[model samples]
Target: MRVLIVGAGSAGLTCAWRLAREPSTEVVLIDAGVDPGPDVPSFLLRDMVLPPPFYWDYAEFDRGYFLPRGKLFGGTSAVNATAAVRGHPWCYDAWGSPSWRWERCLPSFRAIEADMQFGAEPYHGHAGPVPITRCELGGFDHALGDAYVRRGLARIADHNAPGHLGFGPFPTNRIGDDRASTLRTLLPELRGRPNVTLRPQTEAVRVVMAHGEARGVLVRTAQGDEQLLEADRVVLSGGTFGSPEMLFASGIGPADGLRTAGLPVHVDAPEVGANLVDHPYVQMGIEVSDPAKPAAPPGKGALLTFELDGPGHLQAHAFAYRTRAVDPSADPCSAAVTCALLTPESRGRLELGTGRARVRLNHLSSDVDARRMAEIVARVADVVADLASEGALRLPADPWWHADDLPAACRREVVTYHHPVGTCRMGSDTASVVDEALRVRGVERLMVADASVMPSLPRGQTNLGAMMIGHRAAEFLLEAPPP
Candidate 1:
C-alpha cells in the first residue's frame, strides 16, 4: 500500500510511525514548514511559546486577534507548552460514537503514552515513542497550589488519573529539561525506515480526486515546482485548520460556500468546515504579596479543573503562568491565572481564504459560554483573593474582573487555548464529515486522522488527544484487511 499523509504534525507523525512499521506499506509524510533536524532549538523543542511566529496567520473571528498554529515539522506540538493531558473520560464519551467512547479509546491513550511516573499503572503505557512525565513546579507554584487547597480545591494524587479532578501537576511529554516532540521521538524511529519518506518544506495544495476517490495529491515541491504524488490512500492529517482548508480548496465543502469562493463543488459536504470549536481562554493577572518572592515561571506550575454547569458538562482548566501583556522585566512580580472554557456551547466556522482557511472562532458567541466564562473567571479571582488574604499573593489594582460589566470584559478578552477541533467532525451518521473509522464521507481510500476529526473538543490540552487519534487511525488501517 502506498499512503500519502499530509502535514507532519502530531497526528500525521504518529500515523507515519504506525504504518511505516509494516514492510508492505510505503508512507510519505509532507509538511509545508522547514523541518529542523533531530537537534532543534529549545524554544521550538520545549514548552516555550515563542514570540508568535510569522507563519501563523490564522486569526480569530475578531480580526485583531491571531490564533497560533505552528507551521513547522511537529506543528503546534513543536511549539506548544508541553502539556500532555488526555482530559476526563466523559470528554470522550460525549463524542456519541461507541468506537470513540472512553472504553474503546482508552487502549490508544495507553498505547501512545510512555508515562515515566506511572509506568506500572494499566491506564499508562511505559514503553512508547512519546515520553510522558510529571511537571516539576517551583516554590511560588507550590504556594499558589497550597492556597488553592486552602480555598477548598482538593489536591488530587494525579491529574491524568481517570475521574480525578482538582489541582495537580500537568503530565507533560518531556525528558529532563528538553522536550519530546515527534521530531525527537517518533520521527527518529522512522528516519531510516526504507518504506518511509519525510518531506519537509513541501506543501500539499489539494487532494486530486477522480471517480469519487482520492487518487493522489498535487504539491508545490521544496524548489517551488508543482508535483503530483500518486497514492493508493491519502490521509488528511493536516490538522483542524489546514485539513478543512485543503478540503474546501479541493471542492469538498459546503456547496454554496464553494460557489461563492469560485471553486467547483465535488462533494456538497456542508459540515466540512462547519462545527468549528476550541477551548476559549480567560486570564487573570496576579502579583506576589512579598516583593522578595520571585514570580511564577513560563509553563503552568499546577492546574485546577472544576465544573461550571455540572460534572462532565461544562468544565474549566485553571493554571498559573506569565501573560504576554505583562512585562516580565519591569513587573517581575506579576504573573497570571489562566482558565479555559473546556465545554463551550458556542460554535465557529472555517471558510476558504485566498491562501489559507479563514477561521471564524466566534468565541463566546453563545450567551451561555460568555456567561459561564465570566463566572469561571470571577470564581478564579475569588480563589486568588483568598491567596491574597493569606499573604501568598495579591491582585492587580482595578483588575479586569472589577469592571462594572463583567460579561463585556469576557467578550473582549476571551481567547483560544490553541486547541481547535471538529473542522471535519466524526460520527456514525450521514451528516458527519467522517465515519467512526475516520473515512471522509462519500470518498473512498481517503481519511482524516487529526484534531480536525474530533466530534467535539476534548476537555484538556489536545496534543495528547490528537496523538491518540493518529494512533487509533493507524490501528484501524492495520486491522482492516488491505483493499
Candidate 2:
C-alpha cells in the first residue's frame, strides 16, 4: 500500500520511518521546508535560534505575539530548543480513550527515546532513535533550585518520571552539541530506503477528496507547478496549525466558515480548527551583575514544575535560560525566567484568513487561567527576589509580577510557550475532528498523526509527545485490516 503523508515534522517523519520499514508499504513524505539531508545547516542546528527560512513566520498575528513553527523537513523539532519532556500520566489518562491511556502510551514513548540518564529504568528505552539527556544545572540554576527547595518543594531530577514534580534538570533531545531532530535521527536511517520517497520543498495545497475518501493530495511543487500525488492513505502531520489549515483548505471544516471563505464544504466538522490549547507563559528579564560572564550551553536549563489549587489541580512550570537577543543592540548576557501555566482553562480557535490559517490563542481568557497565572508569576517572583537579594542579578524597577493587579499584569505579559496543540483534536465523540485511532472522522483513508490531534495540552513540552503520536499512528495503521 502506498501512503502519502503531509508535513515531515516530528510525527510525519516518525510515522514514515516506521511505515517504510515494512517492505510492502510505500511511504511518500512531503514538506514545504528544505531537505538538508544529513548535513543540516548550522543555524537550524543551533539551539534558541529560529531562523526565518526554516520557519513559518506567524508574523505576530496571534494577539501581537510571535508563534514560531518550523516549515522545514524536520518541522519544529529541527528548530526547537531540543526539549524532550513527556506529559504527566494523568494528561494521557484524561484523553478518555483506552488506546491513549498512560499505560498504553508508555511503550510508544519508550520506543522513541533512548534516555542516556535513565535508559536502564523500566520506564525508559535505551535503544530508540532519539537520544534523551538531562541538562546539567549551572550556578544560577542551582540558586533557583535552592529557592524552590526553601519553598518546600522537592527536587525531582527526571521530569519525565511519571507524575514527578519540583525543581530539576530539563531532559533534552541533544546529542552532544547538535540537536537530535528527526532530520538527524530518523531521516538519516531512512535515507536510501527503497520504499520511502522524501519529497521536500513541496507544499500541500489540499487533500483531494472524492466520495468521502482522501484519494490523494494536491501539492504545489517547488518549481511552482501543481501536482496530484495519489495514495491509498493520506496522513496529515502538519502540526496544530498546518493540519487544521489543510483540513480547512480541503473543504472539511465548519460549514459556515468554509462557505463564507468560498470553499466547498466536504464535512461540516466544527471542531476542525477549534479547541486550540497551549501553555501560556510570561518571561521576566533578569539583568546579570556581570555582563562579561559566559552563558550556559544552549538547551541547558533548570525546570521547576508545581501544582496550583484549581478545579483540575492546574499545573505550572518555570525555567531559566539566557535570553537570545534578536536585536543587535540588545544585551545578550541577560537571562530570563519563564513561568508558564501548563493546564490552562483558556481555549483558542484557528480560522481561515484570506488564503491562510488565522490563529487566535485566547490565552488567559478564562478567569481561572488569569488567577492561576498570576499565582505562578507571584511564586516565580519570590524566587527571583531571592536571587536579587543574593546580588546575583538585578530586577526591573516595576516588575510586572509585583503589580497589585496581578491577574491584569499576567494578561498583559502573557505569551506562548511556543507549544500549540488540539487544532484537530481527537476523541471518541462526534464533535472531535478525529477518532481515538487518529483517523480523521467522516473521511476514509486519512489520519492525523501530530500535535494537532492531541485532545488537550499535556503538562510538558510536546516535542516528545508528538513523536509518540507518530509511532502510535503507525502501529494503529499496521494493526488495522487493509482497506
Candidate 3:
C-alpha cells in the first residue's frame, strides 16, 4: 500500500518513520518548504540564543500574537524551544475518546523517547527515536525546587511521569549538543529507506477529492507550477492553521465560510476552523540582584510548573524559569527569570481572511479569559516576590514588577510553545470534524494527525502530545485495514 504524509513536522515525520518500518508499506513525505540554511541557527541547538535572521512571518491577532510557523522540511520543530511535555490525564478523558486516554497513549510516548539524562523510570521509555534529557540544575532550579517543596507542593522527580505533578525542570526533547527535532531524530532514521521519499519545497494546495473520498493532493512546486500526486490515502498534518485552511480551500469546511471565499462547498464541516484553543501565556521577567555566572553559555535554563487555586477555581497551571539557570555563568552579562501562566482560561479561534490562503487568529477574544490570565500573572508575580522576600532569591529593585508589564519583558514575544491545537477537534458530536480515531467523520481516506486534532488544550507543553497523536493515528490506520 502507498501512503502519503503531508507537512514534514514532528507528527508528519513520526508517522512516516513508523509506517516505513513496515516491510509492505510504501511511504512518501511532502513538505512545502526547504531545509534550514547552513548559516541559520536553531533556537534549541544554538544554546538558546535567538536564531539569526529570523525566517518566518508573524500574524497579529486581537491582543496576543502568533509566531511565524516554520514552513521548512523539519517544520517548527527545527526552530522551537524543544521543551518536551505531555498533557494531563484529564486532557484525554475530556475528549471523549477511548483511544486517547492516558493509559492507551503513554506507550506511544515511551516508544518515541530515548531518555538519557534522567535514567530509567517506570513512566519514561528508554528505546525511542527521540532523546530526552534533563538539564543539569543550577542555583535557580535548586532554589525554586526547594521553595516549591517548602510551600507544600508535591516533589516530582519526573514531570513526564504519568499522574505526576510538582516542580522540576521538565525533560526536553534535546540530545547532546543538538535539538531532537523530527528532522534529526525521526527523519534521519528513514533516510536510507527506499520506500520513503521526502519531497521538500512542495506546497500542498488542496486535497483532491471525488465522490466523498480523498484521491490525492494538488501541489505547488518551488517553481510556482502546479502538479498533482495520486495516492491511496491522504494524511493532513499541516498543523492547526495550514491543515484547516487547505481543507476549506478544497471545499470541506463550513458552507457559509467557504461561500464567503467564493468556493463551492464539498463537505459542510462548520467545525473545521472553529473551536480553536491555545495556551495563552502571561510572562514576567525579574532581574536577579546577584546574577549567577553562566557555566556554559547564555540562554540555558529549566522550565518549572506550579498549580494555583483561586475562588471557584479548583486548579490552574502556571510555569516559571530562571534564565541562565542551566549553566549559571553561561552569560556573565546578565541573569533573568521568566514565569508564565500556561493554562489560561482564554480560548481563541482561527478564521480565514478575505484573500486567498490568508489566515488570522482571534486570540484572547474573551474578557473573562483575559482576567483569568491576569490572575495567573498576578499569582506568579506574588510567588516570585515571596521567594525574594524570604531571601531564597533576590529580585532587582525594578519598578516594572507588575503583571501588566509582562508584554514588555521580552521583545516581539508570542505564545505557540508549538502547541496550537483544537482547530480540527474530534468528538462524537455533529460539529466535530474527526472521530475518536482521527478519521474524518464524513470523508474517506483523509485524516488529520497533528496537534490540531486535540479537542482541548493539554496541561503542559505539546511536542510529546503531537508526536503521540501521530503514532496513534498510524496504529489506527494500520489496524483498521484502510481500503
Top-TM-score candidate index? 2
State, as a TM-score between 0 and 1, how close model 2 is to the true structure.
Answer: 0.97
lDDT over C-alpha atoms for residue 460 of model 2: 90
C-alpha lDDT of all candidate models, in order? 0.82, 0.86, 0.69
**lDDT by residue (tens digit), candidate 2, 362-439:** 889999899989999988888889878988778988777888999999998888888899999999999999999898
Rank the models by lDDT, top first: 2, 1, 3
lDDT of 1 by residue, 32-78 (tens): 98787866766666445456541467776455576777788888787
Write down the TM-score of every candidate: 0.95, 0.97, 0.86
User: What does candidate 1 score in Cα RMSD to the true structure?
Assistant: 2.0
- lDDT at 363 for candidate 1? 89
Steric clash pairs (candidate 1): none
Which stretches of candidate 3 lie above 4 Å from their native place? 36-44, 47-58, 64-66, 117-119, 293-300, 310-337, 342-344, 354-368, 387-418
Q: Which structure is stronger by lDDT: 1 or 2? A: 2
Q: Model 3: C-alpha RMSD to truth? A: 4.2
Candidate 1 segments whose C-alpha is farther than 4 A from its true place: 47-54, 290-295, 298-300, 309-312, 324-330
